[model samples]
Every structure is written in C-alpha cells, then in structure tokens.
Target chain A: MRKITAALLITGLVSAGFAAKEEKKENLFEKKLMQDIKVLNEKIENLYKLHVKECAPEYIAKAEAYLDAIDGMSYINPDTGQIERTEISPMDKIIFENKARKYLAIAKEKVYSDADGDGIPCYQEIEQGTNPFEAEKKVSRAETEMKEQKVSEKPEVKKVGYQPLKMHARIHFDFDKYNIKKDYLPYLNVITRYLKAHDNLKIKIVGYTDSIGSKEYNDRLARKRAEAIKKYLIDHGISPDRIEIIGKGKEDYLFDNNTPLNRFTNRRAEFFVMEPTESQ
Target chain B: MRLLTAVIFSIFLTAGSYAETTTTELLDEAQNSIKAAFESGCPTYAPYEYYKAETYYRIAREETSKLNTKAGDAAAIKAIEWALKAMAKRYGEE
Candidate 1:
C-alpha cells in the first residue's frame, strides 16, 4: 500500500509540472493596442474615401504593409482560446501606430493639395457633387485644340495671372525629404501656369540644402528636390524644354546653422526666370 | 580508514559526471538563440515574444554581472524559452 501511495504521489507531481509548463503568458497591451489599431483603421478608411490611393500610392502601400503586420499577433482568449486579439509589445505597437499615422498624413496631404492654385482642393474637384474641374474651365473645344496644335509651333504668349516680378520665388521643403508640402503646392501651381503661358521663358530651378548632412548626400538631396519641382511642373502642363534643374547644394545659406528656422531657410528651391534673346 | 574510504566513494558517486553549468554558459547560449530568432524575423512577426526574449536576456546579463548566479540562470533560461516561443510564433505554431 505504501509503494502504491508513493507511485500515485509521483504521478501527481509530474502532472502538476506539465500543467504549469502548458500555461500561456498573458499579453499586457491587448486593450490599448486594439484601440489604437481600430483608430488607425478608421483613419485609413477615411483616406481611401478621399481617394488617397490615386494621389499617394507609395504612402498607401506602406500603410497597408504595416497594417498587414498585425496578423498572427497574440492575446487569444487566455481562458477559452476563442478569438485572437491584437497583441504586441507597447514599444512595437507605438512604432507601427506612428508609422501608420505618418503615412496617412502624407496620403491625405496629396489628396487635398490644390493642383491649380485655386482655393478649392483637388478632392473637392474630384468629389461628385459639383465637379468644378471641367465645368469651371469653360473653354471651347476649338480653343483647346488650337492650344494643343500651338504646342508644336511658335506659341503666342498669354498674360500671366501672377505678377511677373514674382518670378524669383523660393519654396521651402521638409527636412531631408523631397516631397513638396501642401502649402508650397499652390505657389508651384502658379509657377506651372506661368510656364504654360510663356514657353519662350526658360526658368532654372536651383536646389539647396542645410549644412547638416554629408556634402555628397546633401548634393544628391538638393538635386532630388529640384527634380521634384521639375516633375510637378511637367505634370501640370509645362514643356520640359523650358525648364532647367540645378543642384547648388549647401553653398549658399541665408542664415547660420544655429537654429531650426535658419536651417529651414537654407532648405529651399529657388527659381530664376530668363527671357529668350528674341523676347528680350 | 574504511570509513574515510567509504565517504570518499560516496562523494565520488554523488558527484559523478555532474559538471555544474555556469551562468556565463547559459547567457551565451541564450544570446545565440535570441539572435537566431531575430534573424528569423521574430521582431516583425512575433514582436511580443521577441521583446520578452530581449528583455529577459538583458536581465540575465545584468544579474550575471552582479554575480547573482541563481537569478542569472533563471533569467537566461527564460530568455531561451521566449526565443523558442518567438521562433515558434513565426511558424504560426506558438
């Protein structure tokens, strides 16, 4: 009987050890992470409604990849093991959440940026209510056809809407990035329209950077910034032949690198307009 | 003389082939395992488990530096377990 009791006791102890080993750890950030993910999902959906996918496809793609990473996360019902919960460490959750928010902001900016410098946003033009895009133009097909045909020939210069003296404009860019900000897009729109109206005027866009990064990197970044403006103008209707892009890098600075505003002043794309010999 | 011989014999039997593992060895093993799990993309796919593994490994190193062999061994063992869990999570098994 003593031997049987010893055997039973040993079996009980071994089973208890196995039970302890099988218990799963609880995920601590289940509640907060779930809330954050829900909010991010709603923000992404709102951006989709604004048609961000068409304007800023890269940002949308990154946002989608981050959202996909949430799959296979932990926090399944610790009691019943029924439903899987959104489960990641607080640091990782913050990383993913902040990335999603950043991308969403970029996408939203692209959707709402004013393409023609009109007070109305691009989304307002795209939305089905009024469609001010074609309706507000009011130009006859004959005039548009004439304009298209004139592109290959010597074109008659139209009076530019903005003041001619405003030709020397500088647009500031975000730190270490080439994406044009929404505030600058309206000014760039004015430049695009001016270029379209005056094909004989060749404008050189000089890019500059702050004294922060390495020389080589700053030169490349400056070139990219100029190229970004060139691409925007070309996309809007400017002839590629009438525009020149140059990267001046960090050679010219408006202020010493002592403050944030000083650095911002240095990170700019400056325009210099020149008339052809015949126009002069 | 016989009692001394028996005592030594018993001590030899008890200590036979039982080389005690040091905290250094446990921590080194855990570090390698954690690195392997990270290379398997545990930080992206099994973020929580990987975080736990990294945290336990840090605690193990701190305890070992302080000469707290018992706590160091415990934390190193936990780090190894969490690393395995992270790898298992990557395979959709954990």
Candidate 2:
C-alpha cells in the first residue's frame, strides 16, 4: 500500500509540471497576439487619419474595412495551439497598404489633372471659371494685353494731341568757356528733329558750371551757355517762344566734384521737354 | 546580469525612438521645402516638376505617419530633390 501511494504522488507532480509549462506557453502566445493587435490598431488609425487629411472618403472607408476584418479574425497557431498573431500576415498587410497607396495616386492624378500642361490644376481652373482644356493666361498678362488692345483700337487724332513726347539733350562745354562745341551738334540735331516732329512740345535749356569759379562768375558763364544753346535752336528754325533758358551755377552736380573727371561731368547743359497742361 | 540586460533593452528602445524622431524631422524638412517652392511660383513656372515634388512630399508624410521610417526617409529625400528641381526650373536654370 505504501508503494502504491508513492507512485500516485509521483504521477500527480509530473502532471502539474506539464500543466504549468502549457500555461506559460499559452501566456507567451497571448502576449505576442496582443502586441501585434496593438501595432495593427495603431497602423489602421494612422491610415484613417491620413485619408481624412487627404480628403479621401473612399480610402477612409477602406481603412475602416481593414480594421473590421482584423478585429473579426482569429490568430490561432495550429501547431502550438496558441494565439500568436492576427489573421493578416505582415506580407498581406503590406499588400493591402500598397493598394491604398495606389488608389490615392490614381485619385490625385484625376483630381489634379492639367490637361493643357498648365501649371494650374484643372480643378483650380474650373473653380476660377476658366476653360480647363486650354492654358489660361495669368491675370497680369491678360490685363496688359487688354490694355494694349484698347490703346491700339483708339482713333488717331489730327490736331489736338493728348500725350506729349518728353526728351532730353545734353551738350558738354569746354572747361570754362560757354561756347557750344561742334562735336555736340549731332546731339542737337536729333533734338531738333524731335522738336520739328512734335510742334506742340516746348524745350527748356538749362546750364550748369563746375565748382572751381566763384558763384557769380559761374552764374554768368552758365547764362552765356544757355544763351548760346538758344541762339543755335533759333538758327535751326525753332520758335524763340517755344524755348525757355535757365542757369544753374554749380547747384546740382552730377557727381562729387573732388576729381577733375567729376568736375567735367558737373559742367553740362541739360534740355528739359515740357508737356502741355490740360488747361493749355 | 539583470542590470546588463536592462541597460541593453533601454538602449534599444532609445534607438527605436530616435529612428521615429528622425523620420519626423525628415518629413518636416520636406514639407518646408515644398512650401517654399510653391510660394516661389514654382507651380506656375514648373508644373510637372512641382507636381512630382508634391507627390513625393505626400508620400513621405503618409509613410512617416505610418511609422515606416525606411520608406519615409527615401520619399522625403526624393521630395526635397524634386522640390529643388522645381525651383531651378522656375528660375530658368537647367
């Protein structure tokens, strides 16, 4: 009887050991399955959020379906008789995600089509009430072309000109002399042609001098320079009443008068073209 | 031995977190680049290149959100490259 009791006790201990081992295996499987589900849930949520941000309702629905499929399926490992993962394998999940990506790409292409190869999308063009089939000119370009066409379509006036041609002619002088050099006659000739072409325009001849001379002396020199230019214009057939003369003695220097070259630049005669006022 | 195992586990966790942070940084940079290109009239001057850059930027954002760091990094790099190309085209550069 004592031997029988000992054998039974040994059998009970062995059975308990096996049960403990099985329980540990089952816990490991359950832990792995839970971890996988958590990861999958996060991925599904991420996909849903992405579609929402993209404004893709169909993709949102697909993400929901994937989540439902995962939740409804089991992950039992047949060999171990334990739950190890979800029904969807890693490869299958990748394929499913790739399908979503492909759908998104196709949707984007359809929505953002630029049929005319314009930088603007077709949907944007339609929103702007423009033809999507053809490239539309930018607002600034359209405005400029319209303005040019309007100007071109206006009738040409005969006597009363609305716009005046403004021009400037310069004649450089010798260091201190007020005499007009022959070298500047070509420039004056161009101005003469312009004045003749536009008879309604008036010319103002202004003279300037370098800073070397006294203000009074330079002023007289500048006056003489203007007078010489006026004499040349009168000799060239321009009306004296159409010209006005002024002398600005070293007042407005074109450059700093520290160097001889800069002083030479300051000693120049300038012509101003005045436009007629509306009252005139 | 337990302390050694704990240190190694913590190091691995830190590395994994660092990878995630890197992906987020890459995505942010790609977004900034794409925004700059668009603001410079790249969409108007270089439509095709701008579109390509935008597509890559979108993919990068999506992959980063999905925690697919490897794919996200590649897409982010592509996004910046295409964005630079768009900018070059907009400025009339080859």
Candidate 3:
C-alpha cells in the first residue's frame, strides 16, 4: 500500500509538471498576439498621418483599403483555442474608429466643397492668387517625353563601386508596451554572436512612433522605447554602452496619414548597423 | 571509534546533498516563475522591476551553482516575484 501511494504521488507530480509547462507556453503565445495587435494599431495611426500630409486626396482610398485589411486580420484565440478576427478589440475599436472617422470627415470636407453654391459637391476651388493642384502643374507629358529623348541620347553612367553597410533590421515589441518582445531574443542572440565574432562592428537603433499624438509626446515615447530596447540588449549579455538609441518621432513619415492601412508602415523600430569608423 | 566517525560523516554528506537538491529545485522553480511572469507580459512592471528580477535571478543561479541551496532558493523565488510585480505594475494589474 505504501509503495502504491508513493507511485501515485510521483505520477501526480509529473502530470502537474507537464501541465504547468503547457500553461506557460500558452501564456507566451497570447502575449505575442497582443504585441502584434499593438503594433498593428500604431501602424494604422502612422499611415493615416502620412497620407494626410503627403498624398492629400489620394489618402482617402488608401485609408479605406487599410481599414479593410485591418478588419481582415485574424488570430488564434489562446483562451478559447479558436480563431478570431477583428480590426481591433471591442475595447480599442471605438478609439480607432473615432480617429478614422475624424480624419475621413476632414479629408472629404477639404477635398469636396459645394463651391458653385449648387447642392452637388465639387472639388475645392482654388483662389485666384494661389496655386492650383500641384500635381497638375508640377509635370507635363510633353516635358517628360523631351527629357526621355535627351536621356536616351546620353551614355549610361558607370555604376558606383562603393558598398553601403547593410544597416536595416526590424525589431519586435510587445503590445501597447515599449518593451522588447521575447521572440526578439533569438534575433538579439544572433546579433550578439555576430558582434562578438566581429569586434569592429558598429550599430545604431532608430526608434519611431506612429503619428497619433503630439509630436513631442511621440518623440519622448520613441526615445523611451529605444532606450528600453538598448537595455534589453545589455541584459542579454551584450555590451550596453555600445548601442545608441535615436528617436525620430513623426518627422520621418513612412506612410500617409489618410487611412489606418497606410499608417502602419510608420510605426516601427529600425536598426542600422554601420561599418566600423563610419561617421555618426 | 573510527567507524562511528565514518557513519557521522556519511550522514552529514547525505544531509548536505539532500539540502542542496531541495535548494536546486526551488531555484529552478523560481527561475521558471520569472520566465513565466515575463512571458505573461510582466504587465505592470516598470522596466526597473524586470531589471531587478534579472538581478535576483542571476544571484539565485550563482548561489545554486555554489551549492548554497537555502539562499539560492530564496533568491530565485524573489526574482520571479519581482519580475511579476514589475510587469503587474506596468500593466496596472491589481
């Protein structure tokens, strides 16, 4: 009877151990999904700003497409063990929808005006003094054809032999939080190994934010996020002092601000590895 | 007299090994807990708390290596707790 009890106890302990391990894995997966959602939201916001600032009227269609794409994304629900899809969680959907609606309404208002005092809407009329649609006047097909004729007449220039150091790398972060995601540990491990293998390597991490808030706020947030990434590197056996963090905020627009879809390109973390002795 | 001494020495060695094993297990559990907290989003923790968690984890790992089971186990548990606390604070968790 004592032997049987001992066997039973060991069996119970082993089963419990396996159950705990499985639970831990499930939690990690959920965290990863949340991180992805956070990033997606930031991207949507960033793209919208870029569309507004750079493309103007073109952003309307881009914004719509982005929203459509966002709505189409789906993920496996860790809790339910099923798939689920939504542009944003019910908690976040209202905030984002309101933001999108605000931008769309403004864009429509600016682009379409009842200029002729008719009930029908038309494009905004230009003031007699101010320039008209810049795209219309900026270039002409006749001028392009003339330029192409001239370019064809000239000899092709030799390609430059200079090789640029490959600096571009994408870093992942957890949802709504600036902390580095655990999945990045593998990439970081590779980076560390590469650096240790190559003593003369120099790198710079540029952090940025989607254009959602004031420029100043985004700037601070970007800097903090970058610093956090640098800290993670230090914690993971990398030399802390060597890494540099730069915050560009919304100054560097990767996408248009017209729609949620286009804005995603702007919310990202970029790493630029430089050749040793390169100027900062 | 020598035989008695041998028996006492053997008992001490066995006891030491048992204590060491217990501490090692505790430290392992603690480390696992810390990882679990981090994996769970250390939701409320300030970055400093994660840093503290790492510090305690290292201490635990070090002590465990040295066979200082008691301190090692305590440090490991503390490390995991700190990690969770940091995440919880960051996430605004109760």
Would candidate 2 be rated incorrect, acceptable, medium or high by CAPRI criteria?
incorrect
Task: Categorize the docking of model 1.
Answer: incorrect
Clashes of each: 0, 0, 31
Instruction: Tell me the tens digit of each residue's lDDT in model 2 across A1-280.
Output: 9999999999999999999999999778657655655765575465443323123333433433333333332323323556443334444445444554455455445446676677876555443333454455654357446645644553244232232333555676768888887767877888888888879888878899888869999998888899899899899999998888899887866555643334555677888675665644
Give the alpha carbon lDDT tens digit for every residue of A165-202 in model 1. 22567787768988887767877887777777876677
DockQ for model 3? 0.01
Stretches > 4 Å off in candidate 2: A1-165, B1-94
Q: Report candidate 1's interface RMSD in Å.
A: 16.3
Tens-place lDDT digits, model 1, residues B1-94: 9999999998987886564666778889999999999899876566557766776676567556767555566667767887898788677452
Per-prediction DockQ scores? 0.02, 0.03, 0.01
Ordering by TM-score: 1, 2, 3
Which of candidates 1 and 3 reaches a greater TM-score? 1
Each model's TM-score, in the order given?
Answer: 0.33, 0.31, 0.31
Error of 2 at A269 (Å): 0.6
TM-score of chain B of each: 0.79, 0.74, 0.61
Which residue pairs collide in model 1, if any? Answer: none
